[model samples]
Target: MAWAGGQVNNPTQADAMKSRLQAIEQDLSKNWEKRDELNRTAERASTELKEIQERGIGLARSLYRYSAKADSLQTRLQQMQERERSKSAAMARRQGQLAATLSALQRMARMPAATLVAIPQPPQNTIRSAILLRATVPKLKDEATRLADELRTLKALRANIAGDSKSLAKTMADLEKERLSLSFLTAKKMRLLEKTRSAEHSAATRTARLSARAGNMRELLWALLKQKQSPELRGEDFEPPPAAGKPETATAEPPTPPRQTAALAPFRLPRGPIPALGRIVTAFGAKMPNGTLSKGVYISTRPSAPVVAPTKGRVMFAGVFRGYGNLVILELPNKDHVLISGMAKISAEIGDEVLAGEPLGEMAPSTSSLPKLYFELRRQGRPINPLPPKAARRNKVRG
Candidate 1:
């Protein structure tokens, strides 16, 4: 009877164990599905971020091109003003010459021909006077012809100036529209970035704080790496509470590239368009008004000039830092980096691969009439004078 009871208990135990195994398998499958869904959501967010970034860049480029057009129009208007001044002076001189010539003709007409010629001292003198009068008639005719031509030219110049003024006004209006569009796009991009960063922060299972206070970029990077590598607890143990407004579905995303060293390795020299569209206002190492030496050159440009990439590389950082408004740093193929700051807006994003001469951003508006950009080049974390010896010869401010 005891042996029979033992066999019955063994069968019951086996069935119970099978039921527990099935339940465990179901839980494992659900966890895997949840993980996959989270990964897909991250990918979609990344895609959205990239799309917004690219759209912002396109708008910025358009704004820059329009600003350039306005500058060119203004320059042409100035030239027209100068030409008008010169022509006005020439017209005045022609008018005076014409008045004198007409007066001489009228005097000759008032006096009888015989009286005019007879009073001259000798027969030859009278003949000479008559000959001179005949010659004066032709000269007067030529002068009148030249004066008419001058008047026409003056009239044309005035008309051109008026036309140019109108055209410039229209161009400026268009530029204003572009500026507004770019502003809107930039704001949108910033919002998107903020949203993405927030989402990433929330989604991360473990986080590291490098210091009690907010840290610099280097420290932020280190903390981010540490957070990524930290072991995450089981969902039932220490899982993050379900976020409010959780997305329903997620798409898969490519794995993010591993972070590289902060310092770029030096490669080839920059051989593309210079970073800024302006004249060098201050050279590298120049004394500043604040009594400090400048690490970068200051380029003064027309408002909102397009700042382009000087070489092919990936963007390292693209955002404001401290007082360096809208700063962008590009890591070159060989590890050199170029820093462009003083931008009104940034178009690129971190890890974006930018081509040489691609538009990166636009100059910010200045308190003065023209905006200024601060540009620098560094190799292996050390800044060098970016302006080459031949830069002076090659430098040109674009309209």
Candidate 2:
């Protein structure tokens, strides 16, 4: 009877252990699948972010070029205006000369040709004077006509400049609108990235804590099984005897509540946008040629691009740190911190509470072909992998 009972109990125990192991494996597999999905989503976002940033940069460059063109046009217009003023002065002098000439002709016309010839003592001298007057009149008439044509040309030039000025003003307004739109889109992308990262961080933390608790439980079970003494099984381990009228298969087990561990504690965190628009030039933990690993990432951006606050945080330190120029450190609400370095200038001061998307500074040497910035996110004074799991795995394998 003892041998038969032992055989039945052993199979049941073995089957239970096997089922538990299968369940654990399934949980692990699901966790990995969720992580992979998240990684893929992050990659897509990063790619789209890069494209949006590029578009923003292109718009900014266009705006700058157009601004220069507008300035040149304005200067040319000013010169044309000056020329117009000078032409007006010349027209005024021409009008005065024409008026004097007309007055003299009127006076001469009032005296008849017969009267003038009768009063003159010498006929040959008078005839010469008349010939000179006739030649002078034609010359004055030609000069007046030439001045009129010049005035018309000046007026046409002024009109053309005015038209160009109007067109340029319209172009500038349109370009400004486009630039503003790009800025808005870029800001939206940054917000999306921050929200995704925050959610993923929370989920991952909970999963990791749960996995650790599960591992502890498995170890405890193994130790219990290995003990030489036969420990009394708790009443919770045994199923109640089948009810008198109901078949065993018909009795349903009550579901247990989920177990919560201390590690699953929640903390408040601020969600915000990325500091700048750029491409990831170097990833975290990259092995350098000098055999040292990188603790943070480097982003390549356009010259003079703005560096903004990634969250609502207080500036802990805002100065140059060794090996990192123009650094600004922000301490977040949960005590997690972020370091922004390699800036051209610093706008925020220490102890200043900066809002998300607030400008911290402009990128240094904004015209570099590849202006790089260093960024790090930290928790409890330790740097963790900020990249998604898939990218981290690939990077690790490559390394």
Candidate 3:
């Protein structure tokens, strides 16, 4: 009886162990599925974000064009209105001259022949008066014709001014619609970015703390880079690139790396482009009013002009820094950094991975005197020119 019980108990222990192994296998399978589903979601989100950003940029460019058109139309309308006013004044003067000429002619026509002969004693004086009357009649007729032409011109000018005013109104309306659309797109983009950043709340909070404690731009950027290197701050989503030339393991597939990490990888050369669409008011290395050499080029943009990223990179610090106003610092590949300042509003947040031509922010509204944007590039903590070589050469020639 003891031998039989021992054998039965051993079989029961084996069955229990088998059941536990099956449960563990099921849990592992479920976790893998969940991870894959999350990856798909992330990919979809990224794709959607990219599409939104591209559309937003296109809309921004359209808005800029419309703004320029509206400004031109407004200027033309003002000039036309001024011309109309001047013509109207000239027409009034012509009417007065014509009225005086007509009154003189009427008085002469009403004068009796006997009265004229009685008033004039000398026949030669009478003949001269008659000659003068003849000449005045023709002159009055010519003046009346000239006045009629001036009135016609004034009417045409007024019509043109009215037409231009209508055009300006239409252009302004179009501009407002485009602006509203862009605002909507911007809000949508923010929502998507926030969703992706939800998991990195702790990292973002730490970055904010670091930014607050930072003394200057350099210190803040240094702290951010250091923090990004830490494993804890990188979060669980961070995936280091696989070892170079390592053999692939068949047991399981490696996780896909995060987009930000891929963007942070070193590149051959950093791209140098103006981050905004505008004219360069202050060139790099130019003498400033304070008698100091300017480190970055200042671009004078239209009111509420769209500002874009100069290149693909990750945002390290984005907020008001020092006296630079709303500023954004992007960490580029190959240890390069780009700083943009003078934005009235910053659309990007810290740790955002931005693509080239992506909307960064916007310049101040037309309320400001002149909206100027500053672009500065740095490599390994030293300031460098942000303009491309060709552009720099062209600027030099212009200078």
Per-model CA lDDT versus the true structure:
0.62, 0.58, 0.71
- Per-residue lDDT, model 3, residue 335, is 66
- Tens digit of per-residue lDDT, candidate 1, span 169-268: 8877887786677566656765665655653343222322222222343333333334335534222222222333533221121122112222222111
Tell me which residue pairs clash in candidate 1: 40-251, 264-335, 265-334, 265-335
Off by over 4 Å in 1: 1-38, 113-131, 199-271, 284-295, 306-330, 344-362, 385-392, 397-399
Cα lDDT tens digits, model 3, 192-280, are 88877775667767776776666656566666777877736532232333233533211111132233224333121122356665567
For all predicted structures, in order, the TM-scores are: 0.63, 0.46, 0.71
The CA lDDT at 324 in model 2 is: 67
Q: What is the C-alpha lDDT profile of model 2 across 54-90, one tens digit per residue? A: 5644554454445445556767878888888888888
lDDT against true structure, model 1: 0.62
Model 1 lDDT at residue 56: 50
What local lDDT score does residue 241 receive in model 2, on the 0 to 100 scale?
Answer: 25
